[model samples]
Target: MSRDEQLRRAAYEEMEKHKDVVEKDPYRLHYHLMPTVGLLNDPNGFIQFKGTYHVYYQWMPFKTGHGAKFWGHYSSNDFVNWTHEEIALTPSEWYEKNGCYSGSAIEHDGKIYAYYTGNVKDEEGNRETYQCLAISEESLHFDKRGPVVHLPDGFTAHFRDPKVWEQDGAFFMVVGAQTRELKGAVALFRSDDLENWDYQGVLTGGGEGRLADFGYMFECPDLFPLGERDILIFSPQGIEASGMKYQNVYQAGYVAGQFDSATGTFEHGEFEELDRGFDFYAPQTTLDDKGRRILFAWMSVPDQNEQDHPTIEHKWLHTMTLPRELKLVDGKVRQVPLEEMEDLRVGPAIQVNVELNRETRVLKAVKGKAFEMEITDLSMTEGWFDLTVGDGIRFVYSSGEQTVTLERKSYVNGVVEKRQCSVKQLNSLRVFVDTSSIEVFVNEGEETFTARFYPSPNNDTVRFETSHQAVFTIRKWDLKHVNLK
Candidate 1:
């Protein structure tokens, strides 16, 4: 067999070896996308081509750690039912011998083109980076075209993750980079055709403009226009904790700006974090046929508590968050769960409107391993409100402090950890509870908290408590598992 075929066979064998063990894990997500075996991270090649949605991710099939990644593929016509496609790309060639890192996909002239980073390391441990391309005429089998863009000047080999878009009959690409002086940056490039690319100057970061000396490195840079303003989203490493922001090990945030495509200049605003919870990084967005910007992010952070995840015991790790629709609301990006997600709702919703003052209630019908809960028309007369799901996962909103907090038991040690964000008022909340995860959307997505919790499978109780007189309506529906085959 050829090298590519040999590598593919090895990956298939690895999956077959661990498939039963991974499936038996109680922490496996019921509705989220996870690797069949080994590890999965970074949603790449997310696009809608020929009326079908395709999502490709970074996968390492042989082990539950980062290594030479294969492009795992999945497709859906209605966005609710997903069909696992064949493996899209494998790191068997000379350019991507080490790994095929993250990138994006674009459709041009009836063909789909994917751009990704070719991560290479020599025997001496020196690194070489290349921006590679793979074309798919039918959105299934990909033809690797090798590296189209090499490492540019003044940047280290930490450069990768090319996000490409078409503007005025020309293609523009944004790449995450680190300067030779070790400053995070986003470099721009232009391509007349898909093969040859010309380097433009740095668009932001690297002490070039207002955002000077932000972080040590930037990864998975995505640039797109939402409404009248352009939004640039990237994950930055080496940013220290600042008050309630940058609390995670690495941060994924965005800047609202205007990009002058002719001059390759970006004038932007301050960086704002996309998600306020743990386990959200490497977010990738795609514009569908209906003119909606939908996003899916890796539900686990790098170098945080990866080793402690209970799923690692079952030979698999990490998953993708639920699809979210992005809208520019009031000068900020608001993320709401996709409307198609409602298709997963099974049976009638259990509805309740209650007034509580220094009371706690546990409705028997509002408990499940996987469900969707929405709290609306909330009005509190005084103190705080708390909602505890499963074992130790708690959501609290303090009126006096004007803050929302999510507390969960740490997977590494049993210590309770909390992540908080400031909110002026708590008007509404939409929470999605899966087998091993919780995604909380506060006040119509002004702020979001995405997390993974490993509570006992039998403990599915959801409790509500209030310190003051608070009136709110709660509606919950059990969600059915999406067909993943």
Candidate 2:
């Protein structure tokens, strides 16, 4: 076998040896994409080819830390069910001896061309990043074409994660970079063919003009047009927590406004976090065949208490968030689970339109590892109300404060932790609960908080209580598993 084939074989062997142990973890999400053995990070190379949707992610098969990463592949005919595919790219090439870092993919002339950053570290521990490509006809086998775009001047070697897209007959790439001054920036590149590339200029961010001194480095910069406006989605490092936002070690948000293709310039509004959650980072989107922009994000944060996750003890860690459909409402991005989730519904769900007073109400059919809940007509939820899921997670909303908070016991310690977001109203709340994670879409995706929490296994009871008189309707579902094999 070739070196890449040998390396891929070894990684798969390692994962198979520990698959049973990892699968036994109670925190293993029932419906989400998770690492079979080691660690999973940024969702990369999300593209709908032919009729199948493929999602690749940064994965290390040996351990939970950020070791040398391979592009782990998963494919889905529909958005709900997925099948794990062969390891797409291995880090055996000299250009990517250290790791095959994050990038994008495109299908041209029936050939799927994968563009990614080949990460290398010299003996002195210095970093050398190469924007490389690998082409495949079957999408499973790849022939490496090294370094289409090399390191440019004016930036640090931290330049990586090339998100490429085709626009107006030419391919454009946006590389997340850190300037020599250590400010975050996105470098724009243009190419007629997939191999040769021409460097444009910085699109935005950095200590340039109005955005003087943004984050230290921006990772996974994706630029795409949304309706009348353009959206620039990226994960920026070194942003401090402001109130209830940016609490994670890093933040993945978007700047939606206008972009000039000729000049490679973008005039964007303020950056907004895509998901207000305990764990969300490095989100990527791809337009489906039906022209819907679908997203999948790493449901775990990096560096911030990575070892705290109890799943690592079982020889695996991390997952991809539920595939969400993206919508632009009032110039802001709105994300909700794809409607195909309804197809996963199995048993009869609870439907109740009742008034909730100060007492707690425990709905018998409103709880499961895989389920959906719709809560609406909350115009009179005057004070704090708690929607408790089992023993751990609690969705608390204070209409008096116009804020929603998700509080749960920390995985490492039992200490209570919270992630809060401000909302103007509490007209509705749609929740999707999968084994260990919960995604809350408030007021039709106006605000959201996604999180991973470890409730006691088999304790599937959902309870809700109000501090005062609150009238709401609740529709709940018992969902079936989307088998990932």
Candidate 3:
């Protein structure tokens, strides 16, 4: 048998061995995508081809930890229902022996062409990187086209994650890279026929004065146009915490700018973080047939409390965040949950209009482990407003300070930790609560906070507390588990 076939068979065997344990975990998300077994990270190869939405993720089927990665595939006709397909790429080829790392997908001439990073390491722990290609005629089976672009000069093997797009009838690719000086950068390249690539200069970073002293390495660089501005989203490592921002171990953010294809220059604005949360990283975006920009991110950060996750005992580790539709509003990116997510609402929504004044109220109907809640038409002429869901997960809005804070018990230690973001007004909040996670969209996606919390399984309580007067209309729906075949 071929080595690829052998590896695929082994992965399937591993899934069979641990499927029961993984399924029994109380924390398994109902409406989110997660590995059947083992570890999953970095949403990859996200695209819509021939009217079908395809999402591939970095998967390691043997254990609930990082290792040689494979591309795990899923497809959906509408964004609501998903079908988990067979593994797309395994780490069986020589160049990608270490792993088939993260990348993006594009549809050209009725075929799906995927570009990814081939990660390889020598015996001495040295690294080698290649920009590889895999083409699918029918979007189900991919045939490897091997490496189309090799490591260029002046870069270390820390380079990977090629995000490709078609601009003006030519294909342009942006790769996350680290210079020999060990500075993070995004290198640009051009290809005429999807194979032969010409190296363009650094589109951003690489110690250029364009950006301040940034991180040491950048990974998963995705560049696309939203509205009239081009958006470049990337994950940068080694950014220290500045106030309430960059508090995560790594940062996933974007800079809105204009890209000059001929000059290979990206005139951009300052970096703005995409999500202000503990467990968001490696985000990838795709433009659908409807011309809407959509994104999916790995809900867990790499090397950030991975071992401490309670789900590790059940042999599965991570999940994908709810797919968000991206919009550029007032010169910044706004992420709103996809309209199709409304299809997950199962029963009649419980609606309430309440006013609070220096008191706490628990709405018995607004409680569930897996549900969606929206508090709209909010008028907070109060000192502070707090919403506590389940056990120790709290969302507090300080109208006096014009800030919103999300507090949850730390997984490593039981102490409650908080992540805060500034807001001008406490207008609206849309919260999605799953078995083990909470995602908050504030003010129509003006800001967002996503984190995983392991509340007591029986603690299905939703409480509202306020220091002074606060009024809002709350509507909630219990979201059903997605149909995954």
How many backbone collisions does model 3 have? 0
List TM-score per model, in order: 0.99, 0.98, 0.99
Candidate with the larger lDDT of 1 and 2: 1
What local lDDT score does residue 37 receive in model 3, on the 0 to 100 scale? Answer: 89
Root-mean-square deviation of each candidate, in angstroms?
0.8, 1.3, 0.9
Residue 67, model 3, lDDT: 79
Write out the backbone clash pairs for model 2.
207-213
TM-score of 1: 0.99
Off by over 4 Å in 3: none
Whole-model lDDT for model 1 versus the true structure? 0.92
The backbone clash count of each candidate, in order, is: 0, 1, 0
User: For model 1, what is the alpha-carbon lDDT of residue 95?
Assistant: 96
The residue-by-residue lDDT of candidate 2 on 258-366, one tens digit each, is 8887777788888899988888889999998898988889987888788988888899888888888889988999998887777777777688886787889987767
Error of 3 at 482 (Å): 1.7
